[model samples]
Target chain A: MSDQMTEGYITEDGRKIGGTLMEMKNITLRFGGVKAITDISFDIKEGEIRAIIGPNGAGKSSMLNVISGFYVPQEGEVWYKGAKRPQMKPYQVAQQGIARTFQNIALFEGMSVLDNVMTGRLNHMKTNMFQQAIWKGKAEKEEVENREVVEKIIDFLEIQSIRKTPVGRLPYGLKKRVELARALAVEPHLLLLDEPMAGMNVEEKEDMSRFILDVNDEFGTTIALIEHDMGVVMDLSDRVVVMDYGKKIGDGTPDEVRNNQDVIDAYLGVSHD
Target chain B: MFYREAGDFKTTYADDNQTFPIKFDRYRYYAVLFFAFLIVPFVINDYWVNAVFMPFLIYSIAAIGLNILVGYCGQVSLGTGGFMAVGAYAVYKLMTAFPEVSIFIHILLAGGVTSLVGVAFGLPSLRIKGFYLAVATLAAQFFLVWLFNKVPWFYNYSASGQISAPERTVFGIAVTGPNTAAWATYLFCLIFVTICALIARNLTRGTTGRKWMAIRDMDIAAEIIGVDPLKSKLSAFAVSSFFIGVSGALFFSVYLGAVEVGEVFGINKSFLVLFMIIIGGLGSIFGSFAGAAFLVLLPVLLKNVLVGMLGWPTDLAAHLEFMIVGALIIIFLIAEPHGLAQLWRVAKEKLRLWPFPH
Candidate 1:
């Protein structure tokens, strides 16, 4: 991993301070007798790509779900921004500017690609049924505004050709891109991509990496992704958190984590002397 | 070339988002409207209009209402006939009690009444969805019918357990009652159907429709997308109920004249309307008409030709119609699950590029 020589996708306006955008303190998520994530504490900083990497059942996805408010931990406090995140409705959580793409592509299968992205803006939009019924004044204006942003997102993701195509008809890579575009459309302060490069070909993964980097660079959007690909988690991320069996085994820069004996042991699932 | 959107330019957002974006579609709609209103009157006699066309128009409204819930929102409902009864009974009672209010207002008021009741039954929707909610709606169906049957006030305490529409008219044109003309009732029904369908088109093309679609596609994802499932699902129920209720009132007041709650608003009626949606097309507005037309006209036409003209046994003819309709439903579902509306679309597409599909 490159260090200090124009490394780390940071904004031009500012420099890094060890200030946290998200702090998961003493996170413990359980299902019945099974503990999914056990007493895991992690912090994500502003304007950085952080990767949570673990084995198949290592609770990497569970951790992401907890952060996105899809799952509530049995015991933990999620500090988003400066305030404690109260137990919120999922939509409420989304409106508070945290958006996530699902592990499995969750685009509205029947809806067109453009509409799938527009679904992300459902929270930002402010219009009622009556205005929509008439469509001459505010509804029309809001629609135009929302559509412009969504179209821009479609263009940004290089999905202009599939704007009118149903998400069901698209290839896996394109669907993942559409899902990313949808999450981006929310204008989220915190963007979570769960295995964005999970099923992509090399070129598709490269395209996705570029988009992820672009999202952080251009929009100043904070990205925390769960990726299984070691190279991606190393190259794209500023810092990486390594986990094994629901516990944080290692947390630091890619080089630090890569060279850590404990991290190697966790990856190999062996005890380090 | 005639049916294509290739050269149809839309400069405004409204124009672009129109129900019929192509000029060909717009003209086709206008032509259909003209035939139903002006031309159909000249050729079809009273027996045809009263016995067949009136029922067709009335059921078409209900089908459109159901389309909003089932087709647009992807919520399955089986309580349509029951809600329609609510409209019918409510209108009947209103007509009897006041005896002075405009029939126009009563029919609409019945719709409002049905909306409230529909919302009540739509409660289980929040907790359970899909087939579960469809089953839940059956409770509303049974309960509504029970309320009308067991509670005497709905039927004006009639011993026969039925509500009848007394003399009702709009501008001296008899719309309902024993002496009411079929032409007047059909006109009244046609007007309501046109307005409701237009409003529904506007809704489905805009934000509300998207909200519903979002909920339908994936409720959990819809929530993350900032759609309030509670409000959107309920509004869908309320709005859909209002339309179903109005159609019900028309069925009772304008068409049936007198209707027994259990007999008229039973599960059979619900399935009948659902068959319309399935056969015609699920979500298409035009599918509503096609469904109503097919379901309504098929039996009548068959009865006249096969049963009456050919001197076939009445029961045999009824069985044959059942087999044909059922076979068609199966074939349509397997071949093109989209239904008659899709067929209409394909035909138009073919017409647009006749002999040059490639």
Candidate 2:
């Protein structure tokens, strides 16, 4: 792990992964008495797709929540960009350029898709309430500037047609796309996606996989995603961290994780003693 | 046909994002403003000004304020009447203390004072939400009313236990007090309503509004997306309170000329504003106006029809008015929960696609 951290590896497709962007060290998270994640340590390299894979109740979502600063691990440190991250609210973490999507689609249902995406730019918009109320020079200029960025995201996601449509009326696939657009609107350094393709059909899955790859390739964003689909995980991720029953079972390239016997047993329903 | 946006292409994001994106809507808005400013003042007598326009305009401000919290921000506040009392009392103190200063400055200061009080009450919303938050604000309502009633300073220790608007003017024209002309007061309130509506519309459309709506739709997600819940919620309270306070000041100083805090700014007042937003359409500026108009006009219309036309007793007409409002509230909630604004929106949408059904 130290060797890999010092000298980043190149993927088979020859995309150079940078040094560690985020590192979790000895993370132990518990909800009262039940341990959600126990002693999980993994590093996400910059400009690489990192996957956290586990079966149901394997604490995959919990790990994502911890990364997004929604859940503070009972023990262990979170290091970002060579500095130890402090205890902060989720919004503060987002201000530090960490953005995530929910397992359940968390789009603002009452708002238009454009508005929902614009919310991701909240950290970037700096005009005070007074300026916003008057909306003449500073507020209007800032809004238009932000709107340009949001419109780009909407265009990139091919959601321009539904820009003015309320998110509650959008289909499942479109909602997921809009969520991705929102996350992208943040211009985040590290993007965390919790089950980006959970309930998606085959075509939707393919589209989402393409979008994920495109986001990584275009933005050079460090991607940390929790996914159930083995095929998608193997194809998309440069490194995979396999968890089972609140423990890290394996951490390596997708090829190495697939070959690991513990990972195989965990997925194949090996009973715990 | 005229409501359609077919050829109305926006060249820039600014053009696209203007309050009224459609050219027809923009022109219509301008026409309304022109009529309100120029034409209405000349035609409106004291009866129309007092019975219809003043209450509608003042209540519209209150409804807009409440809608910011309840509709746009998704914070259910039952303390609007309390906040309004803060404004009324604050203005009474200001008006009496600084008699030479402009009434406009006093009203704005009153709103500022109410916003501070609102923020203080809004503190609990960070921890609680939904019905519980509503109840907490309800406490603010009762406590505020009680404080004003108990404190002598609020009513200036008048023997009558009421605060009356001292004569005040704008540019040597009396806009307040018993001697003020009907047109002067109406025009004064119309200016405020227009300004408040514009400010409310701008705030709700800009980044602040987005932050608020984000907090409203989903707090946790909003927070994760970088919207500070504390700032957003408190700002909603502050802004909402400001508008409510302004209306209260206007209601006292400009509209009614004298007010007793308990009788006027009571729990009923809070519910009235809430009903306006709910029946108007939660989260819409136009809904705020629509709801205020519906409520303010309903009683007057009822009185004229039942008492004047049918020759029914006034007391019976009043009771029937309450029954009708109650039934309408239930019907609106059940049938069109978004209220009259949504109905208007659907009509416009249909109109845009008229003469050819898909």
Candidate 3:
């Protein structure tokens, strides 16, 4: 069903790496004299897996944070769908079809898996607090409708077994999956993942890779992720941007970036203590 | 076997998302409603209505209100008593000003007025949090009580500095003031309690409730996920105050009939309701009712056992009641932090898996 709907966005290879969705032009972020990102520029196309890969403190997460509206660059123009995005709150960015997962796993630990996902439908829900208090007509109807959407996401992620369990009680890998489920619940046009496979084992990585690919294939969601694992980045991303010392060192297909000397040096040349 | 859901299946989302999902639980809810509406009114007398039922209903409404703010929204408020005083004074002024208006409208308008006051006081919560917000609300409580006491205009310059409910009727039956019958007052408060519970339950289960809980669990994540902290926190205060205000209106006009602002809606009243939510369960409506019933019954039981049957002094029984309430609060906080609601939940879990221990 999703494949048919996403046909216009996908190419022959079933990759929907089409039309520029977000353009970051000369983004320079600063933290009180210390630069987090300097003169970085990139464009993420619709329905593509765009990875920002780098070593520790490489400003990859900072770039993702800028895109997600958690941090606004001191000097830059963020253009989304041909319009320059204005100064807005993170939630406002989410309302504009941008959803993200944190590197540290930002699931609501106190809530059940179902509820954590239901919260992703916050911007989508239109019922006001008054209607909700009464729980009649629109509020109840909207709840059931959103619940159906949440249930579908839960099923897609194969987390039906722990639907009622609190997210805090889940294992680490499962928690990561739940975070993805939550981000997907937003039905975002651009999904940002900050190290989705940060603390996972080999099998967990494979499972997450499958889910990420399936999500892109099925929903045609444009994804932008920051990952440290070079192998996973090479296998999953259509185009990879390499950052080093708050600067963009390389940007191309995984295979093209692999042969780039600057990219290789950033990883291999840097000496460890 | 009794609690099993073998044959019961939900064909729709509404059925699955009901306030009480289990068949047994649903039936029990209906039975309780049935008893409250049909059986209790006929058998109720002055003592039971005044001493037990009325206060429980009123306090439950207040606790439900407070729970939405503190329990659901994670905004600590100690100004509940002040907000309640606003309701009482608003109702008193409205009832006196417009003698021709219905008491119901007066009470509702009072709730609206209290909502405005609640929002004003709740403004600080957007910037401050935790114990700081609590202190801000504590200030509100003291200031409101002082304003009502010192401001003679609030009491119509009666010189006694006390406000008394004038005789009022709903459908030709007196529900407030001296001429009101026990059953009339009981049914009046019961109607409000039922409606309040239904609304509170609905709000807490739906989208608004999710936003509140999201704010409660983690405000930062809630903001990232699209919950506006300002709107969420303030709305919690407004809705919570509305309920508390109505209870205050009932507490003064319907329940007490004559009230001194300082003595009736004091800091102690705030603590009392807070204790009710803590003992009953922080975030559950049923817990609110349970806590109210427990506290209300405690005093009466103490009086019955120590003063009535045992022929002990009334003051001694009152002192013992205080000690018992204090001790129970400590025990509940230590043993079962979630209070009676958690206890009830564990019981249901055990019942569901009866005869089959894992």
- Candidate 1: lDDT over CA atoms? 0.85
Off by over 4 Å in 1: A1-19, A271-273, B42-44, B351-353
Compute fnat per model. 0.62, 0.91, 0.74
Give the alpha-carbon lDDT of every model: 0.85, 0.92, 0.89
Docking class of 2: high
Candidate ranking under lDDT, highest first, comes to 2, 3, 1
Give the per-residue lDDT of model 3 (tens digit) for A1-273: 121121235443665466788889899999999999999988888888989998899998889888878898999889998799998888888889999998888878878999899999988899887777778689889999999999999999999999989898999999999999989999999999999999899999999999998999899898999888888998998888889999999887788799989988988895667
- Tell me each candidate's i-RMS in Å: 1.5, 0.6, 1.1
**Per-residue lDDT of candidate 2, residues B1-358 (tens digit):** 6778888888899999898898888899999999999999999999999999999999999999999999999999999899989999999999999999999999999999999999999999999999999999999999999998898988889999899998999999999898999999999999999999999999999888988999999998999999989999999999999999999999999988899889999999999999999899999999999999999998899889999999998889989989987897898799998899999999989988887857
Evaluation by lDDT, superior candidate among 1 and 3: 3
Arrange candidates by TM-score, descending: 2, 3, 1
DockQ of each: 0.60, 0.90, 0.69
Choose 1 or 3, whichever is better by TM-score. Answer: 3
**What is the C-alpha lDDT profile of model 3 across B278-349, one tens digit per residue?**
888887888999889888898888789888999988888889988987897798799999899989989988
Clashing pairs in 2: B71-B283
Sorting all predicted structures by DockQ, with the top scorer first, yields 2, 3, 1
Model 3, position B138, has a per-residue lDDT of 100
- Write candidate 1's Cα lDDT for B92-176 as tens digits: 8889988889988988899999999988888888898789999999888898888888888777777787777788778987878
